[model samples]
Target: MKALVFGADGFEDLELFYPYHRLKEEGITTHVASMKKGPITGKHGYEITADIAFKDVNSADYDIIVISGGKGPEKMRLDKDALEIVKNFFKKNKPVASICHGPQVLVSADVIKGRKATCWIGIRDDIIAAGAQYEDSEVVVDGNLVSSRNPGDLHAFGREMIKLLK
Candidate 1:
C-alpha cells in the first residue's frame, strides 16, 4: 500500500513522524508532500524531506493521505493544490488521517461537513462551524476519516489509521 503525507514547515514533530513511521512498520510505502520539495522543519526542530510537491501529487497513486498538525496546516490550507489533493482523497473515499491542526485543511477542502471528527481544542469551533460533529475524544473515526486531538492522541490516531488501512 502507498500513503501520502502532507505537511510544511512548523509541523508538530510527533504528529508528523509517529504515524509516518507507524505506516512504514506496517509495510506501507509512504511519501511526504509539501508546498515544495526538500527539507521542512518541524515545530520541535526536526526536519523531514518532502518527496513531492503538492501541485505534483496524483491522489490516485496513493491508498491513504495523512495530514500532520501544528502551524503547517495553517499554510497548507491556503494552497490551492494542497486543498485540491485533499478533495480528491475524499472524492475517492480513501483513508484520511489527520491530527491536531490537520483538520483545518479538511475544513478548507469543505469535506468535513457532517463527519464525526476531532481536532486541537483551539479549532473546536472551526470544526463545528464547518459542519462536522466535533468530538473531544482522543480519536474520532468517521468512515474513511480518522482524526485526533493532539500529539498526546497520536497512539489512538495511528491505531485507527492502521485499522482502516488493514
Candidate 2:
C-alpha cells in the first residue's frame, strides 16, 4: 500500500509523523505532499521538508491520503490545490483519514457530504455545516474515512488508519 500525507504548513508534527512512520514500518510506501515544494513548518516550529509537492502527486498513485490538523487548516482551507487533492481520493473511493482541525480542508473540498466523521470539538459545527454527519467519538469510521479528536487520540487514529489500509 502507498499513502499520501497532506500538510500545507503549521501542521501538528505528531499528527503527520506518527502515521508516517507506521506506514513505513508496515512496508507501506509513504509520500509527504503539500502546496509548496520546500520545508513546511510545524506548529511547534519544526520543519518538515516535503518529499513531494501537490503538483506532483496523482490520486492513482496512492491507496490512502492522511491530512493532519493544526492552525494551518484555517488558511489551508482556502487552498484550491489542497482541497482538490483530497476530493480526488474520495471521488476515486480511496481511503482518506483526517484529524483535529483537518476537517476544515475535507469539508472545504465538498467530499464529506453525507459521510460520518469526527474532528476537534471546536469544528463540530463546521463538519455538520459541510453536510456531513458527526459522531462525538474519539474515532469514527465511516466507509473509507477515519477521524479522531486530537493528538491524544493518535493511538486510536493510527490503529484505525492501519486497519483501513490493510
Candidate 3:
C-alpha cells in the first residue's frame, strides 16, 4: 500500500509525523509532498523533508491521502494543485484522513459538503460554511473520509484509517 501526506511550512508536527510513521509501521510506503522539494518546518520547530513536490503528485499512485493540519492548510487551501489532488482522492473513493485545519483543503476541493467531519474549533464555522455536518468529537469517519479535531485525536484517527485500509 502507498500513502501520500500533504503539508507545508507550519504544519502541526505530530499530526504529520505520527500518521507517517504509523502508516510505515503497517508496512505502507508513504511519501511526503509539499509545494516544494526539501525540508519543511513545522509549527513546533521540527523539520521533515518532503519526498516530492506538489506538482508531481498523482493521486492515482496513492492508496490513501493524508492531510495534516496546522497553519499550513491556510496556504494549501489556496493551491489549485493541492485542491485537485484532494479532489482526486475523493473522486476515486480512496481513504482520506484529515486533521485540524486540514479540512480547509477539502473545503476548497468541495468534497465534504453534506459529509460529517471534525476539525479545530477555530475552523468550525468554516467547516459548516462548506456544507459539512460539523461534529465536535475527537474523530469522525464518514465513508472514505476520516477527520479529527487535532493531535489529541491522532490515536483514534490513525486507528480508523488503518481499519479502513485493512
Among the numbered candidates, top TM-score falls to: 1
Q: Candidate 2, clashing residue pairs?
A: none
Global CA lDDT computed for model 1: 0.94
lDDT top scorer: 1
Q: What is candidate 1's lDDT per residue for 1-166, written digit by digit as tens?
A: 8999998999999999998899999999999999999999999999999999999998889999999999999999999999998898898888999999999999999999999999999999999999999988999999999999998898899899999988
Mark the regions of model 2 whose C-alpha exceeds 4 Å error after superposition.
Answer: none
- Model 2, range 1-166, lDDT digits (tens) per residue? 7888888678988898888888898999998887777888898887887888777777788999898888767877787777888888888778888999989988889888999999999999989999989988889999899999899999999999999977
Model 3, range 1-166, lDDT digits (tens) per residue? 8999988999999999999999999999999988888999999999999999878887788999899999988888888888888888888888999999999999999999999999999999998999999999999999999999999999999999898899
Full candidate order by TM-score, most accurate first: 1, 3, 2
Each prediction's whole-model lDDT (CA): 0.94, 0.86, 0.92
Clashes of each: 0, 0, 0
lDDT of 2: 0.86
Candidates in order, TM-scores: namely 0.98, 0.94, 0.98
The TM-score of predicted model 3 comes to: 0.98
Question: What CA RMSD would you report for each candidate?
Answer: 0.6, 1.2, 0.7
70, model 2: CA deviation in Å?
0.6
